[model samples]
Target: MAITLSERAADHVARFIEKRGKGVGIRLGVKTSGCSGMAYKLEFADEAAPEDIIFECRGVKVLVDPKSLPYMDGTELDFVREGLNEGFKFKNPNVKDECGCGESFNV
Candidate 1:
């Protein structure tokens, strides 16, 4: 079981951390809300919890809590640009469906 970030995603995150001036890495998690029952949650981590699972990719750290591991295992995160919009995209092997608005997913 593993979660990783694409090189572009890692670079993007690293730049954000540098600009913010304080962060150890980025935390990725899931929350129960949204039309499809689950939505992705992201935040800059200043410190890590004892139970957090950390994966190092492309010279950056991607942190995940133990509870989210099963749902996010084998996920590869990417940062993409489409026309004028750009954001982090999740390539999750466990996702069975996503909401029409693309805000949430169900496995």
Candidate 2:
């Protein structure tokens, strides 16, 4: 199992980290909340945890905890701008369905 970031995502993350002044990478995980039973959690990591599984993509590091791997395997994060709204998008192959609001998903 693995997680990845698109070139656009990597560039966005790298720029944010540089501007923020400190970071080792970005953390990707799932939490048991939201209408679809699961929601994606993202944050900057100043340091990696002992159990984090790390992957490098386009010069940026993507970190994931073991428990989240099954649901997020083969997921690629991308940054996009549609008119004025912009954010990270998850292209997760394991997702079976997502909530109507697109804030959560369930396998």
Candidate 3:
């Protein structure tokens, strides 16, 4: 099982890490809150935890907690732009349903 980042997503993350001057990679996880029961969480990771699973994609590291692996396996993180709107998107194979606001999902 693994999680990955699109080239654009990786590029964006790399730029952020460079700008911040220090970081090991980005961490992806989920939290139990939101209309659909789960919401994606993203943050800069300064280091990997012992229980974290790391995947290298597009020359960037993507970190995931062991507990989140089953739900996030085979997921691809992407960065998208549509006119004035732009942000990270999740392409998750395990998602059965998503909330109207696109902030959460249920498998």
The alpha-carbon lDDT assigned to residue 82 of candidate 2 equals: 95
List the pairs of residues colliding in candidate 2: none
The deviation in Å at residue 91 for candidate 1 is: 0.6
Q: Model 2 over residues 18-99: C-alpha lDDT tens digits?
A: 9999999999999999999999999999999999999998899899999999999999999999999999999999999999
Model 3 spans with C-alpha error above 4 angstroms: none
Q: Rate the local accuracy (lDDT) of all candidates.
A: 0.93, 0.95, 0.93
Best by lDDT: 2
Residue 54, model 2: Cα distance from true site in angstroms? 0.7
Which lDDT tens digits does candidate 1 get at residues 1-107?
88999999999999999999999899999999899999999989998899999998988888999988899999999999999999999999999999999999999
| True-vs-predicted CA distance for residue 46, candidate 3, Å | 0.8
**TM-score of each model, paired residue for residue:** 0.96, 0.97, 0.97
Residues 1-107 of candidate 3 have per-residue lDDT tens digits of 98989889999999999999999999999989899999989999999999888899988989999888888999999999999999999999999999999999999
